[model samples]
Target: MLIYHPAFDANHCLYRIVSILHSANKTGVSWSLLRLLDFYYLFPAQLKEISPWPSQISKYKRLLKNIPQQYEDINNSPRVFYDLEKFQKTAVLELIAKGIVSKESFEADKLCLVDDALPPSFIAYMKSDEFFNKDEFKIITEALPMVGLNGPQGLKKRSGLMEYIYDA
Candidate 1:
């Protein structure tokens, strides 16, 4: 069986993380793809800048502390995307804006992989022992598949794609 190491392949890690978050959240209330990217790339300092209010910062900090196992930050700086060649930031933004999955999504979900932002295999691998603990796997596996073929919608519009996603 193939195993994914986030330290070795951060791009795949980001992709998988986004898909997992999207799948795990309930339908119609799923996090936007931009939000997932922020969760992965935005450092604590960046978060602080955006969350000026103490209560908001505290709430976001708590949320960050509870991120999935694969995303646990040990060092001071939070991990950020460094896969500009294989996974260009621009391309990913386009994907989120257009709901177009990369060719890699085919490896994650054969059917509707190109159309939907989240794929079945992405969730499956995340739930596998390769990344998550048994309890985490069980919870993630159970919740991720409750919805089908759902993609992240534009945070502004509430339903369809947004023409532009503001740069962070």
Candidate 2:
């Protein structure tokens, strides 16, 4: 749903998605940055905000190949469905601070696993109450195209300024 928000900042988007991964419980899969980018832009809404330049997209793909994806190694898998620690990066943890990385874990220096699943908490947070409702859906649907995810135009539609933008 994030592709075309017009206001989509790649760093912010990746940061949020990474935060979601930190909370997941799955152990069998890992998210390649390229794969995650495709997933985000895979949806219609996500691309609406993305620049169409191939070079820009490729630059991000290159980062996935080079950046560190794993936050830490699992000592014992959590029984819970979401293993929130999986996706935490040093920067993100510092930003929110539940307690910085386990000092022991850092000194232990074990092999870390990359998180594959997206966080449900974030997905739910992104969804709207009017999501499946017909009337609101109609309004949002009608609103997306005026600027196609590029700026204040998309924001206006999502925000209650659609009429103003359209009429202006």
Candidate 3:
């Protein structure tokens, strides 16, 4: 299953994944691996109206693929299972390649570990005057609910708290 998004590339996905992992590690939150995968898979759908690249509007318009009704119904849907697995692997590989994240423990139950205490270039990229002032954080914040981590006990407290500090 090849799942690609017009609004974001491997860098974009890696940025999100790393940011989540970095925040979770900092906050000591026990985020669910399953929820992380679902968030990445459903991210593109959250930005159906906005194109990351404005010049290529038509390309982005075509890229707004419909999100599955049930992101967590992977067990009953083989296609969903395959897509999520593939996307998660690809995103993780990108994170590793960029040195933003590392597998803390591959055991049956271990959260991902931040590879570096220092911030990655992606974070710098996000903070660069050109992009940072553009309010990309607003888009990311808006997409939180669609990513399915907006519930009170979900990632809102963890990631949201981190975002508040990060934005400040």
Candidate 4:
């Protein structure tokens, strides 16, 4: 039987990446933080559990409070993160190849949007409540400031998604 998982879908990963970078704006975000945020965005229950909530409260607090319970795949998160690694790389590479995201920023350990503005359609879709869980998106965007509070190593340590001690 064929199975489909968002973790393995390049297009879905691409869309998520774009949404993240867009939320990040021109300031850009470190690759590590992006990966962590991506994981949370994909598995919101995990996000709700581990998020530095006091430091990054969303304006949509009611939405977060009322958020429907999602499966908490905490035990599999690290494995899922690793499993999604290749697809993430693929999505990043495709973005660079298409000139939508900056290769130089990527090489420098950050992911930055090359264009000041995404195509109007993409922007509309990204902003639309119909296409995305608006509350989740708001939460993720609100969390962007945490990228500065923790360096890549610090964020990795916080997430426990990867062994950060030996990371260079």
The candidate that wins on lDDT is 4
**Relative to the unseen true structure, what is the C-alpha lDDT of residue 63 in candidate 1, on a scale of 0 to 100?**
41
Off by over 4 Å in 2: 1-8, 19-25, 33-168
Model 1 Cα lDDT, one tens digit per residue, 132-157 = 45333323333223322132322222
RMSD of each: 10.7, 19.2, 12.2, 3.2
Candidate 2 Cα RMSD after full superposition onto the native fold (Å) = 19.2
Q: TM-score for model 4?
A: 0.80
Tens-digit per-residue lDDT, 71-143, candidate 2: 3332432221122223323333343233322333333432112332335675465454333233222222332
Runs of candidate 1 exceeding 4 Å displacement: 1-14, 17-21, 24-49, 53-61, 64-86, 90-122, 129-168
Best by TM-score: 4
In model 3, the clashing pairs are none
What is the TM-score ranking, best to worst?
A: 4, 3, 1, 2
lDDT scores of the candidates, listed in order: 0.37, 0.31, 0.41, 0.71
In candidate 4, list every pair of residues with a backbone clash.
Answer: none
Alpha-carbon runs more than 4 Å astray in model 4: 51-64, 71-74, 129-133, 147-153, 166-168
TM-score to true structure, per model: 0.31, 0.21, 0.39, 0.80
Top-down lDDT ranking: 4, 3, 1, 2
